[model samples]
Target: MLELKEITKIIGDKIILRNFSLALAPGESVAVIGPNGAGKSTFFKLAAGLMQPTSGEILLNGEQIKKKTHLLKKRIGYLGHESFLYSALTPLENLRFYGKLYKVKNIEEKGMELLKAVGLHYFKDIPIRSFSRGMIQRLAIARVLLTEPDFLLLDEPHTGLDQEAVSLLNLLIKERQEKGIAILLISHDFEQVIQVCERVLILNKGRVVEDKSIDHQRGLMPFKNWYEAAVSGK
Candidate 1:
C-alpha cells in the first residue's frame, strides 16, 4: 500500500536520506530502527506527505502521494513522539473535535468507543492539562484511531509510559494489525520492536543496512546484539 522509489531528502548542504527505497503491502507490520540522526523521521515525513523529497517518488495505493496529498491525509494516522493535545480541552471534547474534522460518522459514538479503547473513558471529562503524560498519550492515540486510517506511522510511541501502558499498546497494535492496517513503527524500545514487528529494517547513515523477517515463532533480540553485529559487519 506504500512504496518509495529512491527517495532522498537534503537540508542545506546535508543529505538526510539518500536513495532509500521501501515498500509495505497492506496488512504488514514493519519496524524501522536506527541510531539517533539516521533519518528515520525524515523517511516518515516523506511517506506521510509532510515533507517533499528532493529526489525520487512516494506512492500510496498505486497513485503518486504528491498528487493525492489531501486524499492521502485522510488515509494515514500519525502518532508523533509528543502528544499534540489541547491542554484546555477534555478528552471527550478533543476526540469530538478531531472526529468532526475527520468527518467521522456518529462522532460522539466513535469518540466514546475510542476513549474506551485507549483506556481514557473514565477521564473523558477531565481537561488534558490535568492529565498525566500517559493519559495525554492515550488521548492522542484515540484521536489517531478516530480517523480509522489504513496506514499508521508511529514515532517513539512508548515514550513516557509504564510497563502496563506498554502492554496495552502491544495489544492495541495486534488489534490494528488484525484489521489490516499497515504499520511503520519507529521506536527505541527494542523489546517492543522484537515482539510486534514481522519485518525489521535497520538504518545507518541514510541507508538501510539490514532488512529481514522474523519468523512467526521468533521474537525480538537484544539491541546490543544487533548493534554489535552492525559494527562488526556480522
Candidate 2:
C-alpha cells in the first residue's frame, strides 16, 4: 500500500504541485492523464523516492519513505522517460548489475527469462548503446521487473514501444495486477491503458480534477469521452 498526503512541490515562486494526494492498495492500477507540465512525472518521482517532496510525505505501508532507501528499493519500481541503463554494458551485463544490487538469487535464469520476455534474448550480448529506442525501453522494463517491487511507477512507459511490445507491456500489467501489485500508469494510449488500469485520475495544473472508474466494457469510448470532456472543461 502507498499513500501521498497533501504533497506539494515548489521551486522559486512557481508551484509545481499543489496539495496532491493519492492512496494505492494492492491489486489496484490507476492511470493518470494530464497535459504536459501537469506534475505527473513529479508525482511519480516523489512516489518512487527519486526526489523528496517539498511538503507533506509519501508513505509506504505505515512509514514515511523519506530517506528510506532500502525500503524504497525493495517496495517501489520506477520507469520514467530515462532508461537508467548503462549504455556501455550489454543487456545481460546490465541485468547482472541490477541483479547484484537487488541480490537476486538466480541472476542468470532471471536475466534470461526477462530478456526473452522483452524480446531481447538474441541481443543479450549487444551493448545498450547499439540498441534502438524501443529496445532500450524494453531493457529498462526488464530492469524494473528484476526487483519485482510491490508498487510500479511507470511514467509514459509505452513511449517507444511497438505494437508487439505494447501488448507485452499490457500483459505484464495485467499479470502484476492479478498478483496484487499496485501500479501507477501514465500513458496517452487510452485504449491500451484501460485494459490494464481499473481507475483513471485526470490531473490538471498539478491538481487532480477528476477521479473515476474506467469502463473497459465499452472499450475506448468511455475514456475518450472522459478525457475529451475533462480537457475541454479547462
Candidate 3:
C-alpha cells in the first residue's frame, strides 16, 4: 500500500499541493486528472520520490518512504512523457539496460518476453531512433515492467498513442492490476480514465479538490467538462 499524509508542496510563493492525502492499495488503479497546471505531474513525482513535499509524509507498505528510499525505488516504477530511452540502442538493448539497472536476473530472456508482451518483439533489434513516439512509449512501459514493480506512476501515458496502442495499454493496465500492482496514471483522457480507473483524484491549483470513484461521479459532467473547468481555473 501507498499512503500520502497531508502532503503540501510550495514553490517560491505558490502552493502547488496543499494538505493532499490519499492511500492506494494493492490491485488498484487510479487516474489523476485535472486541467493543465493542476499539479498532477507534480504529485506523481512526489509519489515516485523524485521530489519531496514541504509538509507531509509518503509511506509505502507501512514504511516511511524517505527512510527506505533505495528499497522504494525498487518497488516503484515511473515513466513521464520523455521516452527515457537511448536513441542509438535497439529496443532489446534498451530493455536490457534498464533490467540490468534494476538488477533483474537473466536480463536478455526477461527483456525479450516483456518486449513481446508489449508488442515490440518484432522491432526488438531496431534502434529507438527509428521508432515512433507510440512505439517508444510501449518500449518504455516494457522497461518498467521488467522491474516487476509493486507500484506504477505514469504521467501522460496516452499522449501520443493511437487507438490500437491505447487498446493495448488498457489491456496491459488491467492485467497489471489483476497481478496486484497498484497504478497511478496521470492523463488528460477522461474516457480512458473511466474505462480503467475505478477511482480518480482531481487536482486544481496544486490541491486535490475532488476524490471519488468514477461510478460515484458518473452523473456529473463528462471529463472534458471537468478538464476545462480545472484548466480555466473555474
Most accurate candidate by lDDT: 2
Ranking by TM-score: 1, 2, 3
Candidates in order, TM-scores: namely: 0.94, 0.93, 0.92
Local accuracy of candidate 3 as per-residue lDDT tens digits, 111-171: 8888888898988888889888889989888887888999988887888999999898889
Distance from true location, Cα of 23 in model 1, Å: 0.9
The models' CA-based lDDT, in order, is 0.85, 0.86, 0.84
Model 2 spans with C-alpha error above 4 angstroms:
none
Worst 10 residues of 1 by lDDT: 215-224
Q: Over the full model, what C-alpha lDDT does candidate 3 score relative to the true structure?
A: 0.84
Q: Give the candidate number with the greatest TM-score.
A: 1
Global CA lDDT computed for model 2 = 0.86
Q: Per-residue lDDT tens digits of candidate 2, residues 1-234?
A: 899999999867878899998999999999998888888888887787777888998887878888876787678888888999999999999999988988888999989999998889999988989888888988998998888889988888987788888888888878877889999999887876787788899888889999988877888876687788897674
Could you tell which candidate, 1 or 2, scores higher by TM-score? 1
User: Clashing residue pairs in candidate 2, if any?
Assistant: none
Question: Across residues 88-132, which tens digit of lDDT does each residue of candidate 1 receive?
Answer: 999989888888877889989889988888888888898889888
